[model samples]
Target: MAEHGRRRWRLVLTASPLQGHMSPMLHLATFLHSKGFSITMAHSDLNRPDPLNHPGLTFLPLRDNLSATADFAGAGQFLQTLNDNCRPHFQHHLVQIIDSQKEASASEKESIVVIHDNLMFFAGSVAADLGLPSIILRTSSASFFPAINIIPQLLEQGRFPVQGPNNQILDNEEIVSELHPIRYKDLPFLCTPIEQTLKTINMIITKKPPSAFLWNTFEFLEPTGLTHIRDHYQVPVFSVGPLHKIIPTHSTSFHKEDTSCISWLDKQAPRSVVYVSLGSLANVDEKISTEMAWGLANSNQPFLWVVRPGLVKGFEWFEFLPEDLVNQMKMRGLIVKWAPQKEVLAHSAVGGFWSHCGWNSTLESMFEGVPMLCQPFELDQKVNCRYLSDVWKIGVEIVAERGEIEDAIRKVLVGKEGEEMKQRAIEIQEKVKVAISHGGSSHNSLEAFVDYILSL
Candidate 1:
């Protein structure tokens, strides 16, 4: 009964089972859905406790979802396991779903187009098998793409670990400590464990096509990196971002955290509250979490903290805070387990952010012109933090991790040095806003990318 050769090719958004991986893809899915593209977002039944429900976007649950691994450990182990398990199961599940969808929609000749996470290596094969056009959504910086794509090859070629005395994979401590310009520490956390990292990279190198890459950065921010990818791959790579533009012109509520958090911000003076959140996916061991809490408590500044459930390690640790500090923070601070981040960042009361320097957080903060207190954790965060401090001059890093957190907060919040960073951040915010507005690079790239997708 369907119109011949005129069927809409529904987009299937396939993501790895992590919040950081999913959020930006969902942001794009939301955009495509708004533009009237039918979207079926495939998620791991193995992961979500409560699956997302969007009106236009269909959430298709897969049996044997890759996220359900029996060997789940702490955050570090879990991510590595996720990296390992995701590829095989996702690839298998994708083939099954496509075959099934094709049968059901057989009357219509239109096939599917997959917008998949770059980390999901299996999608490349599945796309080819089904003769579907697949785009690898590189949600991280374009600057990091070459390093990411070549990591496995580099290990095979002996380009990295150039000067280390030991086989870099064997010397765990040496890997974290040595390596200049970008240390193993600065590398994405997975790269710190070189053998394990090589496994992940091998998957990428073996499966990815030259023309399949799509990054979440605009030309203005990462022209050199994008150029590097193109020169090396000899394929078209798209950079369409500050995806924030496609989000509702007015924000929508996504998290169930206390709404009062916004009201508290309303009461605070404009650009006065320092917002603190390490993206939902990253977890600090108890020591750093305690240090951060004490640092914030001691700073005595108004703050809004997003403490996602289970992000903190130990319950007993919260008792270390003096009751007086807790009272003071309660009066001046708003602590929610999860937040609608884009909304909070866009709010007038938020002056700066204390971030873990995840790419999404970094881009969103930049897009909002919110300066960062860069406390980088694993992975590409170190590089993202460096860009903030060295390239953009919109943030500062804490030199001494142990005792300097309080000083870092005070410096970004109220001190004379803080004033300079504050002004620079606001200036950057204006730049970001303009770039995403009409006639901006991101805007132009977005239209072109959509056109490409539509053409397929």
Candidate 2:
């Protein structure tokens, strides 16, 4: 409680030590901190070395003794490590952190609310043990919420065992009619029929139910999917998006380059360059990497491609790019390991996005009103692709399978249909801009959400 008898909300947000999860959650944490929430953001010391910076917010680092390779493979391995190595010890460690904080100042102590990324499955139990409210924060698409919430029902309906050879299940209209439009591939790999996987996901989702599912989206950007979630979940779903706007960084965080990319973009025509990144998490294999490199070279488009060293499977394979081809693309494009994504997307030169369909990237692209060449690798990506192409009409899917890769890229870049998609992207961008304005739905929802937290 504060001077005016206002309750100071104490919140602990824990992330899964992945860049995508950490980034947006940090944005949200900072936004809440600005609104006067007492925040303690916890990260695995192994992943995020430095503490998150925000005035009045404390950062706690936990040692995750598991092998680093666990996160590289996929979310399945990550969840298994969480269940086997992290979960058993998390509650005790969390209490210790809370106790340490409580001991520091008498006035600072209150019932701590836990906000965790989806992978932090044991948090609900941790919150329960501490007699605090827990909320699940997903940096992924909100449309997936209704589907995730109904996993048990999907399982009971015999959908799990019917997966096809390539991990896609044959589409069944009857099954699709009942649940949110989630394909077998779109579900997290951890949500498998294997007894342990099923049990862990069930345990986690059932406990938290996402505590008012918050997405990095705006209403008009994907109205149908938003409506679907509202109709299905019957719970408070907050779309506080173009998240970059709510929590804009004072400046970019540069590990490799200074702010040189913006100057390069200034010379190009508006909507001329394609911004390419598969996000920090998705590892592009050598073959696909080389193919994409070749396709970009062949298209003769001015582009900005972020090719971080370890993002491709192996270092030696990067040498496979023919010297001539590399030089040619360089003349027409800019290639770097990383860039300030929000800055780059907002630039005038950025015409489109060639994305892996991660929700963070999707929202960033939406924030800029840039159309996307949707290439969803796995998990909720397929669902995101459906929403972007079918529901929102903001972009077109570049590849459903490997064979469609080059064609999809060409279509989105130079084809007449691609031009139409660009117009749709601009239209949605305007709608999103309106939604976050002073009297907009998202603006009201954000204030309402913060007010509710303050009341708690």
Candidate 3:
């Protein structure tokens, strides 16, 4: 929406194509708009935010040149391609916008700040070339940077490939002293092939530093992470998060969110349904899906699950399940392509979240005071899962085995341990509530971020 008041400003923001990344960037834009700054969202065409969903904001789509039919490459190569294809187009469009703004009246033009996701670092260089201020929006956890920074030393110490399918490195080898509760095995860098992981990490590291780093994380949840990143980066760092709640924005979902589950949740008892969603990425095999279905059914708890198209590797939605089990699941659960996550989590019947532990999901679960069954698939998700299960003690690590999934679901939904974790979650959520209110850390940091932006 348009900025209100005399001193005006505008934010031209861009985000990675993934839903997890796009949601927070849009939330940031929405939140900043509330603070009297106009917003323009520049996005890749692959997952463009709908102009209808965001009434007052402008949507500038950059040519991603990604074929919908192209075979999917690994994360590293895919990101490299996105950057390469979008750079020249991004620069040209940015220059056009800058030149156009120069022709507008003072009130309409407003000062512009180019804010972009770390994965879209090309935007930062374009902004730098245009002599405009730029900021980095880290959509993942604050702990990510420091964890990746130590990889060189860990490699020198011969810690690479710590676990060889029969080793104990995954169990807990040398602890990362700087970011405690995270060991070598839990590093997000190892989530992909080593060469590719290094390729992506190198791309991230070599980008020019921005004026500031805005993290979608709060202080209480990652004090050490925020501390480490700020100290290491030596730039202004702001943790203004649960951004979806900060200003309560409209959805920027790349996929249409099925809201019918909310009504299904209405009939269940308070804290009775276990909501399972693996987010926009993470794919599981048929075996895992079958086991998960049996587990949710066996837990004897009503559940809601998001079975995204192609979520099962090489298969469609659980068509392979036997008719009887499918019938049982139909009796007790609701499955949608994608649920309105925040609404689902906030529902009174949702007691637990079976998640992929993506940072956005983690923060949403924590903010809603819902405990989790952690099944991190890749990237920073592993780091967040470790912190949730081992450090915060609010989540339980789960496997795809029917028995384990059943037990974990039951534990989170009804057991004493579940109660304890729920209490801690609620307690942490209370503090988080305070943090977003006036005179709190996130509130203060957000204010400082706004002030810093205005200072330019």
Candidate 4:
């Protein structure tokens, strides 16, 4: 903590433009600000947070030629473009902020640190060039972080680039050292071609590791995964998260959230509604979207669904719903473009989450004690879904077929099996609350992190 007569230290924070990445990063900034550090946010123009929303913080929006709507062929390409386009802007603004702080009175110029999203590869370089300490804020699980570090080993063993008879490589359940037992299919960024994979691997491995690695997860939630990272990597690691629980007022959604769904939920019975959303970026084909609609209708369960504008390929928003399907939804469903997700999960009527298992959503559901019906779309979501079902026993994965979807929903919302899952979810929810409270594991870790930043 800063002394009464001394000036507060400043911390500059940056994040990738994506919603999932930006949300947690902002929450972290809020948490640190509450701890007495002056906050400075450096962000790209794409999906930029309104500076007015965060009054005490300094907001720097960096310029980039890339349009927010520019189409990338895939996630890897998008990431590569972000790094290329944002690097100079980020570095330039970062330098300006550091210099500005230096010009402040000696007490106010005590120290400055940079904490950046792990995906913004250029942040580490900028920190080094400026001779400042930095920390990497990993938006995903600690379990998923080491996968990037082991791509070389996987290639040497001929396990990655995942080629084999009949695409059999995806079926092989090999236990990789840093990760839990997983098939090739569960690997993060697996859809990227081998060449792109190598490029990403090189980018990550070549960078100077930051002074500390901060994960948006609690120690108890992923003990084994945390241990693996600490044992293999030399940098200091801190697990100080389920950040939504810590900083609830920080808004991170790129889209305006609809809070009206809470009233609809209030009309339903406890543990009856299945909350459905596919996150901000995942798009489903028309076939899968149609199947999901009918499946939800057939389950005879009330639901609150978020159908983002571009959620379905080649269809207008909710126009893809057939007339009869629309009528059925009117009877038992509520649809919105975007939802106040944390609020929806906390509602009494929500029994389960039908989700893409994005880490933020998963943690939110866990924090609320809502079981999941997982349909993992891509990247770390797949890994998170694996842990939800196999390790945590709080969710069940669903296939895209109507029958499979219906069955999974029925199992989670009605049957004895569903009750068991709900009980487990509630148990985890209690543990999460404890972890974020004072003197809890996550609380202690957060305090330690603050102390480190102040010391520097």
Candidate 5:
């Protein structure tokens, strides 16, 4: 519960422009606002949250470089441009906010703190420069958190840049004992050149670290990973999440959610539909898309597929579904440009998810007790897919071939194997509910986080 008569704390949050980064930060903002703190979202001009979606929070715009709205060039370039360009603008803007607040009457005044997504480390630096406390929010799972710094470790050992025409580290196939069960190949794929990757890594961690890190994960999900982070950082780390369930916030989606898919789902039988979405950034090969369409049709299970614009690389939209198989897919599938994923997952018709294994989608699927057909694309997704399939035993991974795709979808939706996976998922879903309840781990952690903030 929020402390009574303590409404003078104001939080300044910086949200990264990517869809994946924007989401969890906004949910955190909503969660904090409910605890009686005022929120000011300092973000790039592109992909700004709709003020109507979050009524109580304020949105502040920072100047943007052209790269803000352009297609992602690469990981390092994107972060370098965002951090280098936004640093001075954000610093100056924060100074102005601090000065303006000083002029207000004491009764109307509020103390300030800077909280931001992990990628936006520049915010913490700016805050430290002005002598204010700041916090960092990790948008991915706790298990995936420590794996992020692995690239630097590999580089130090002189084994990176993966010799040869194909991308394979010297120890790509070996199980890393320190990482336990994850191979070098399975570490989050850094999409930038080795030098750029090193540069990006150095930039984010070399600064004075934040006061705390707030993870969008709970103890039951990845206790070991959480422990690794606490030992490594030696700072206050809070696991107060599955925040979507804690407080249901309005859509921070970049695309308009197509509600029409819900009606298609309504017409299907219970536990009969396979839901597919590849998230916002992953691009599939044209051949793979064609094969996936045929594979879904071959599975004979009813399915709802989100084929958003740019799903097939170099194409405007997924209009290239082979003219021959179009009729077959129409008979048993509903295709939409986008979907309201949380609602779709909860619907009785959705029995399985064929996903790119993005962290947000992974958490949503887990929350609804739906088994997953994991097809991790890159970066943190590979780490998440590994845990879901190996650690949790609730997901089935698939190769990109049509025959394998069909079999995996069936295994999650209709076969006895799917039933077993569904049961395990249901068990975890129940645990999730308990974690957010009174006196639970996540619940207590949230209380601790609040007290820590108040103390600061």
Candidate 6:
């Protein structure tokens, strides 16, 4: 109700306390705000966005009582801590938001909607208790979201908790559905105990179904997964993404991004440099770090490598690079604490990415049409690498050995096979550009999402 037919829709959004989760959530909020909706973002105190940095959007930090260091333990522990400690704070703030909306005058009163990241299951509960329309945003691919639903079936079939010597169960691929062909290795939390898997399953199932599902993936990228989710779920599913392409924003890194890498890339030949980064959370042990260093040096190709602090276990920063490897990297490679990833990907010199296959990095590389050398460490990274290598043919996965890493780099950077992979990536890039433009699938889906929120 508005005095002069003015729109007064307000959205409350919450994301899990992780860099990957927060980045996309911020982008979505920015997009909605641009579309004439007022936005309020509830975030964990750790890694909270500065409210001053984002005008017209209110930022509320929930007291989770956990330090930022909690993230280093891994995804399972971080998620468990959030669920255990953040619920009361989240609920209390949500009630306050609802009360504030109710207190407004009739014409100025806003129609409140809640959008929460899939990992923040508690937000959904609060939304339901308050009778607000809630939308669950799966920041990863549509494929990864449905996989969690079938964990119990996998457990019953003795396919989960991937037991036995060296986890032999992961070696065999089973068709979960006509849409999803998965191996045990692609499942997240595979190394964790069955109790952890059960807890995740229970958490997902116990939540009341949201009004709709929002995915940060395009239709062409995950057709079968999208189809399966749409057919199986009762709510409407919207696939409107490569979110970065749709709404380009500044660097959202918890650490500072070194833009000097762009200047370094300027000196390299077009498509001759490989960009390597393992993402925010994936850690490489000392041995693997050493192997990677030598492998990159041996590749003899120009590279821009981001060696973040705490990336190597039991060592500080770039201390992992050996003396000999440092000499080799002198002219051929540039190592920075962190690089502006999107800028690096878009640079002409960068041809392939050595990445952890985090969904954000995956989408960014694809959008920029750069081929990838995927070294997925955990979580949805494995599933995303499967799609990149097996489904899309835009990238290749690397084995942990130094020789394999060196070979993968050469294959992607200078080999004839890499040219064809680059072509495929370019095609995907064109399709993504079209999808985010006017009269495209993702654009229409986003409009539909807005319309649904208005109707509510």
Cα TM-score per model: 0.82, 0.84, 0.93, 0.94, 0.94, 0.94
lDDT of all predictions: 0.68, 0.70, 0.84, 0.83, 0.84, 0.82
Q: Sort the predicted structures by TM-score, highest score first.
A: 5, 4, 6, 3, 2, 1
Encode model 6's per-residue lDDT on 68-178: one tens digit a residue. 664445455677678667779778877776688677777677777889987888888878888888898888887876677777777888767656686644544655553
lDDT (Cα) of model 4: 0.83
| Clashes found in each candidate (C-alpha, N, C closer than 3 A) | 4, 0, 0, 0, 0, 0
Tens-place lDDT per residue, model 2, 335-394, is 887888888889988878989888878887886888898877766777788788877777
lDDT of 1 by residue, 1-456 (tens): 112246556777877666667777777888777766778777665554243345667786544434333565344455444555555655665677666765675455445678888655556566776677888887787766655565565557765544444544421222322222344445553435566566555554434463356678778777777988777767668777766565663332334656668888898998778898887556566667767766776677788888776676655224545677578668667778777787788898988898888888888887777788997776668778867886777788864353687788877777787788777777876766777778877777667777777666
RMSD of 2: 3.9
lDDT tens per residue, model 5, 372-395 = 998988878988888888889899
- Residue 22 miss distance in model 4 (angstroms): 0.8
| Per-residue accuracy of model 4 over 1-456 as CA lDDT, tens digit each | 353346567688889898888888888888887877778888888899987677677887866566767887866677777777777877777677677876788665656678988778777778888898889888788777666667667877877756577764454466665566655677766656777777776765435678888888988898877987777667788898888778755567899999888988989999999999999988899899999999999999999989999889987588977998899888999999999998898888999999999999999999999999999977788888888988899999999998998999999999999999999999999999899999999999999988777666
Q: Look at candidate 6 and tell me the lDDT of residue 295.
A: 87
- Candidate 3 deviant stretches above 4 angstroms: 1-8, 100-110, 163-174
Flag regions of model 4 displaced more than 4 Å: 1-8, 97-105, 164-179, 204-207
- Best-to-worst ranking by lDDT: 3, 5, 4, 6, 2, 1
Error of 4 at 420 (Å): 0.8
lDDT of 5: 0.84
Compute the lDDT of residue 198 as modeled in candidate 4: 77
Cα TM-score of candidate 4: 0.94
